[model samples]
Structure formats: C-alpha cells, structure tokens
Target: MLQKRICIIDDDPIYKLITKKLIQKTKLYSETIEFNNGNEAIIYFEATSDLPDILLLDIEMPEMDGWEFLDEFCKLEKRINKESTVYIASSSIAIEDKLKAKEYKCVKEFLSKPINLDKLQKIAEQN
Candidate 1:
C-alpha cells in the first residue's frame, strides 16, 4: 500500500500520543499532523498545502466541536477526497453522534476511542 498523509485531531493528550505512535507503526502515512482541538485542526486544514489522505478526528472538542469543524471543513474542497477522507474516533457510544456523523460525506467512518491498530489498518484499506 502507498503511504499517505494522516492527521489526528483530539484534545486528549494521552489518546493523541498513543494513537500517534500506533499510526506511525502502520507505516501507512508519509506524515502525521496532530491538533489538540478541532479549531486548530480546522485552521491547519484550511491553510495546508494539501489535505491529508486520511484524517482521524475526535467527535467532541473545545472551541470547535467535530460537527462545527465539519461544517467549516466542508466548505473547503481541497481538504479531502469526496466521501472518504475523514474518520471519527470518539469515546462516545451515542447512536445520535454516530448517525449525525453520517450526514457528512467526507467522514469515512466512525471508530471508537483508544484507536486500535487493526482499525487504522482497516481504514487505510478502505479509504
């Protein structure tokens, strides 16, 4: 598989650290950019040279929530591949959150927190 760009946006430091390490292990991404909150991620995405091939975003965050980030991000066409660039990784098991994420076509899928290596590999395979 080709190595692609990956970005992870989450407020939890531990989660971000662990997941970033796991993501690196996959050797699937040419580079990995991380943000502590949705707003920062959104800002970077807006100004970045190219959209990450894969984006791992948390559902909830301070400043800008994932939904709000999506709203802003959707307006930027260069930030993703149609319907398959971003994935939601959250601790929430709320059906509503998962269902709501589906409203955004760029959201590849929703995966629960403490991201598993298998899941990341699977995401790479899918998108």
Candidate 2:
C-alpha cells in the first residue's frame, strides 16, 4: 500500500489536533500538513512543487475562506497535480454551503466536522 500525504486547512486548532490523532489511527498517510487558513495553504502551494494527496478544508476561516481558496486553487490547477483531491470538512449544516461545494470540480466530497476514524480510512482507501 502506498502511503499518502494529507493536508488540513482550518482555523480551529482543536479540530486540527483531533483530526491529526484520528489520521494517525488510520495509519494510511505518511505525512500530514496543516494550515490555519486558506491563505496560508495557498501560499505554500504557490511556493512548493509538492502537494498533498488529500486536502480536508473548512468553509469558514480567517483571511481567505474555503470558497476563495477554491477559486485560487482552480487557477493553479494547470500547474499542480490533478490527483490531489479536496474534501470540504466543515461544521456547517447549511444546505446552501453543501450545494456551493459541489460547484468546485476539485472538491470530491463534503464531510461534516469531527471526522471519524472510519471516514478517514474510507477517504484514504478511495484516494
């Protein structure tokens, strides 16, 4: 089995910590990258040639939200690896937010917050 790299883009430190622990339990990813907001992740993406295999994104964040990040990411699509999949991991239960996520081609799925071990394992397997 090939080990994958996962990136988490969110403002919540607690969520990031908990998710990282859950990711460890899955034992599927060799590397995990974290960003406090979409802007930070965008900067990293712009500066680096390497990209994570999977991205877990949050909708609401300081300085560049998920929607804005998606727009910027689309512009970099031609330069970046197409294999990288993005998943919206937000706490929002709004139907509008979910619908908005579907507009982005890079978004694979919209997952609720507090992503469990099983979901992480399933996401890794799918990728």
Candidate 3:
C-alpha cells in the first residue's frame, strides 16, 4: 500500500516537533513536510505537484495565518489532489473561528492545539 503524505503548517517549532512525532508513532504517513508559515507552504504547494493527503494548519503565524492560506489556496488554478484533506489545528476557542473553518470545503476537521494520538489515529483510520 502506498503510504499517505502529511503536511504540517505552523510557526511553532515545538508544536510541529511533537505533532510530527505523534503522527509518526501512528505510522500513518510515509512522509511529512513542515512549513514555518503559510506563505512558505503556499509557495511549495504552488510550485510542486506533490500535495499531501492531509494538511494540519495552524491559525496563528507570522507570515500568513490559516485563514489567509485558505484564501490563497482557493485561488489556485490547479485542483488539489482529490484525496487530499485539510484540518485546522489551532489553539483558538472562539466560536467565530470554528464557524469560519466550517466554511471551507477542504477542511475536514478543526482540531485543538496539542493534537492527541487518538485524534491522529482516527484521522489515519478514516483515510
């Protein structure tokens, strides 16, 4: 079976590290890509055909936030992989944030910060 590809877009290094480790422990993805900011992630997505099976996006970042990234992502002419799924991973508990996330068709779920193994496992199983 071909392994899944996962991408983590966040400004927090420690969060990225821990998330990556947890995902790896699940053996869900064959490879994982990390981006410091949404701008960098957008650049990579625009320039390459290698889209991930799942994208874990953070709402707060220096360059571009998750909302901004989603806007840019919507503008892309090329379609994202049909199997690709995006999940918003953030610390925001604001109701507005959750509602906004729901507006995006590509977004599958809104995960709280410090994603746990159970959530990862469930996501992995679903895919």
Point out the higher-scoring one by lDDT: 1 or 2.
2
- Residues 18-50, candidate 3, lDDT per residue (tens digit)? 999998998878999999999998899888856
Tens-place lDDT per residue, model 1, 1-127, is 7887888888899998998899889888788889888789767766753567888889789899888888877877544543328889999999999999999978878888878899888887876
Candidate 2 regions exceeding 4 Å error are none
User: RMSD in angstroms, candidate 2?
Assistant: 0.9
Against the reference, the lDDT scores of all candidates come to: 0.82, 0.93, 0.87
Most TM-score-accurate candidate: 2
List the RMSD of every prediction in angstroms.
2.0, 0.9, 1.6
Q: Can you give the lDDT of residue 3 in candidate 3?
A: 73
Q: What are the models' TM-scores?
A: 0.90, 0.96, 0.92
Task: Tell me the deviation in Å of residue 71 in model 3.
Answer: 1.0
The most accurate candidate by lDDT is 2
- Which pairs in model 3 have colliding backbones? none
TM-score of the candidate numbered 3? 0.92
Candidates 1 and 2 compared: the better one by TM-score is 2
Per-residue lDDT of candidate 2, residues 5-33 (tens digit): 99999999999999999999899999999
